[model samples]
Target: MWPNPTIPLRIKLSGTPREIGLEHGRQLACQIRKQIEIYNTMFKETSKLDWPTVRDIANEYRVTIERLTPDIYAEIAGIANGAELDILDIVALNCRSEIALGLFSDGCSSLGWKFKDRTLLAQNWDWTASIKDNLVIMSISQQDKPAIHMVTEAGIIGKIGFNSSSVGTCLNAIRARPTDPKKLPVHVALRVCLNSTSAALAIAQLEALGSLASAQHILIADSEGPVGLELSPMGDVYLKPNDHGMICHTNHFIQNRFVDEPPWLSGSPIRLDRMRRLASALVADGETVTREALRKKIFSDTFNAPQSICCQEDPLRPLPTRSSTLFCIVMRFAPSTRPTAQIVWGKPGSGEGDVIIMP
Candidate 1:
């Protein structure tokens, strides 16, 4: 039997109408319930969810209900929050491995007139394994209105996808600097991205968020062939050329402006080193030039010991002492292909599932 199977669900919503009314709220709540049922069924798990049940889950997670306005949005947000709890419960039941690390990411667009317009993409990998797989869902309406975008995988709700509005995003552990718990969790940032519809809008959101957690590097890619390299604390942003046909980002900042600290301090030195080695190997093998070659290189673990691409609970250090977990994720955007290409490390059943397509 599979050690543990986590379900991943990704959705894309567009052309949704935004209006506030009791009927609208009821419809939104029904949609949220459907999403929850889909997530639970996907993982063969059970979830105790209702409008009120979901609301309580959101409250327990400390998620803000203000953004989930329009009554329907609020109900949907509550369901999304409850989905997160279902994922946690599943992990507690089936996770046989010690110290399973989970990761979450979000990319948001068009929030509050562009004050915080940047998409928020984050990695939440530490003590618990993030939702079964990297799952992201989003909803976008006409400009100047609230939309509902909910993401859940293996019963966990958050953000994890790249679609027409925005690109899927992930983070590489570059620095192991201590962070404050009071600040917003990285998962919240991923949710922010799921809420966005464009790269420009996502960037604006990041800028408006200001500084919450410690300094870290964010890698964002949009369906429009835009790849962004941004830094927190300093709030520096850089853009890469998508004209080259394809773009691939691992853990580490490509920009010189971003400093590279010791992995001991960054908690990803070895993983970063491994990613560098993989990149170098790919270049040596002449795979760096092609998108397929790059994907092959990312999955290669020639070193054997201390598997370069595998996720580690404690990478040469304890959790409390380490900055973040070392997990591997490769986001590839190839519009030339019939459908968008997305491959995540953990999905369901297979442990490593096939590439998921978003249309």
Candidate 2:
């Protein structure tokens, strides 16, 4: 029922981890199974990872996730049970990058800007076009914390979203190597950030990752402010709005422990430079920035053809590894006005925007 104008699956679960996982598994059985199979073949061929090795790596991260947050593990277990799949399959789905290396490295182009009375965060999620069917907007309600709302792939527990607590997060995958399966993966960390009550708390959660694999930029913001933090196995970098009132990130590390690490995604530096120039031009013109302008900039495809921000399918990328811009999401968080988000179902350049209030 998900993938509707709003969310098809407006799920609300509050109970034990098993209970939550089971309900989630049952609710998304079809999509979950589909996602697992696609990832299985991709992982096997791309990373030379067998099912057993993938499982072993996932289980290792499972232990780390449980040690850090048992509730999430229980939820994952429930998903496995409900979906009628091995727990290791669910683990591998969450930790797909750990085993498959660069298989799923292409991610998003994102930023956060200070609006007059609220905070605005936006991004373009680049993923395998086949996974479009795996998209779902999940709303999770636990006992005491604020409910979490995320636009995620079926089996993945996190990607992008906000919470009733007013905290919001966005992510962009950085293609750095030497991933430490011992620490938290980006998906798990996103879930952890979703539960945070404030911006500071969300950042604290990231700071606590110790070391992480598959480096990524985690941009967080509440009504008060925004913080851009990059996490990797070696070290970390934290950034904020520039004098121009903007913080932007693409699929590369702005700063990191690995000084010489090359840009993971081919389009990363290109997009980063493009967005910076766009932001600078906006500031220099002294023009009033609106949501429309921001979206237009994100949807720009001036650079590298198929791999540009408003990406279209490429002829060179084989069918399985080929990806495109799945969606463009813009969120506004203000204490006074109910949080509102605008989403374009396909490439922002091609589709119209749909506005939804965070429930």
Candidate 3:
């Protein structure tokens, strides 16, 4: 289960309050509660959640859901309303495999490479999913505000919609040297992206929102490509590509530029090495580029277990105390006809969805 279930939702406004409305604000709050309840019911079945209870939880966390501009909220709420199914439930099904594999990350970055045979490789890694049962599903749209749907053993807290103007929908974990609860939660960045429609807009939103905490790297991918944006609270931002046809990000920073700054303290390089090794093995096999092959590689227990993805202290030397997988996410964005297949393995042996197209 997640060490903490209380995720505070902090909304920062960039424009005037006149742009927002009361009805839209109430609707956004209602939708957030609905999505959270859907998650709690699906995963935390024993505990039934009511709208009031959900609001109470949000209030307890000091989450100001109303800070989002009304226009943005209306756009996002419209998408949530249009969804044929409960967005949270759909995400739960989409990530069933990772849930089964017990792979979770603080953040994740993936590259959707278009190869010669109309094939694509959706390579990704968990930054903090290793932390136990922290499962989060995030989405960002261009016109609407961004939202995050998070699920842990405790239950669900952040419930955002899917779709972004520029970056599409993405989620990542930002590694902080000294963990601080006061800083804006990483989910806020996700919300910003969800609210953005285009990459240019997303970038603008990031600049305006500013940083509440010191973050190491961000896991972002969309129809365009995947990017690992590393940042410091001081306003330094670095961009890296998932050039390896396949890229898996962990909590530790992986750029050579940042190597000189406390490599030992930032993140575990050894874990990165293991992921690289696995990627190499898969690429060598040639079949790793396929979505199915990538999934097999990601869920392989031969290299490690408990934490499906390894978290090592040192790549050169080995040490225990490493973290394991909490939830695994395999995102495949092929032609619309080719269903976006996601296999969630919440447990060992069997899983709950179809290999061809996630539930």
Candidate 4:
């Protein structure tokens, strides 16, 4: 079932990045606090580090984030002020993967399908189920940039969303040789992608971040077409749409040359293959893939139980250690005047979500 009707806190704020962050923090203070607790607990259980040391380490990530982009830094600072938390704690939450030191990675499915003049960009972000109620969708209007509608976990600056510029990004985790402590974290890099107006620009930004942006598959799409990157702080790989005119990326690297590192997420290989077949069947060649049709495939659970595409918490694992499909999102940019993104909270096919319009 959907986590709860009260979930997916939606806020629309237009102003400077800092101002937007402050309003975001003030409105979602409860969730921000709860999410912080959850993240700290996960860090403790997974890594031997305590929350205090995590904060100190978060300072380095702060530098990375700041050096990467000043606007994002101000936004984080504003969130810290509005939420009444340390800037480093918020930074730590954003850099959770780096904090884990490459021990954990999440699963997701991102696909792009075209029909006529429309493009469908969709993803299912699978993570810890505990944050189902802590999820949020923030509509941000910043100076000199396109308005953004972001569907993400509390305190995450970016994830799956489309900008008013018709640019959309979907993220998937891939194992790298271990994160370089000096580079930008995945969450921070995602913010850079959302700020971009085109896939080529995002690729340039990712390249600029260098090896720090590594160990992930990032799919950047616009009304024209889409581009995929298997980024590593060491180097980056470029992925193009296959002959089927579709791109389906799971947690593992699909590019033969880039699949050297093993995946941190279990069942990644199976999920990738399953999603490809499903995408082929759901979106035929040269047919306009409607939002409804894509949504149905996104929420499919042919495997069901613990291993299904729409994952559920495994009874065999302890409560805090399990991960599930937290949310599913479909971002349609060309069907309407502005970008419209719909989400599926908690389990798939529940059909409960809010329509986010960025005008």
- Any runs in candidate 3 off by more than 4 Å, and if so which? 1-175, 178-184, 256-268, 301-326, 334-341, 345-359
Q: Per-residue lDDT of 255-338 in model 3, one digit per residue for the tens?
A: 524322433323334345666676677767776366556556644332433333422222342221233333344544333323
Query: How well is each residue in 1-359 modelled by candidate 1, as lDDT tens digits?
Result: 22233324434333432222222223234343344443333222223333344334334224322332232234333343444333233222111111111111111110000001222222223222332323333333434433433333332223344444445655443342333332333445544554566556766776676532434444565545445444543345564643332233334444534343333323234444664555556545754233333345444342332323443333663322222222223334333432133343341122454543333
Alpha-carbon lDDT, every model: 0.36, 0.76, 0.38, 0.74
Best by TM-score: 2
TM-score (C-alpha) between model 4 and the true structure: 0.91
> Which of the two candidates, 1 or 3, achieves a greater TM-score against the reference?
3
User: Model 2 misses residue 49 by how many Å?
Assistant: 1.6
Top-down TM-score ranking: 2, 4, 3, 1
Supply candidate 1's per-residue lDDT for 60: 28
TM-scores, all candidates, are 0.51, 0.92, 0.53, 0.91
RMSD of 3: 11.0
Among all candidates shown, the one with the greatest lDDT: 2
Locate the minimum summed-lDDT window of 10 residues in model 2. 1-10
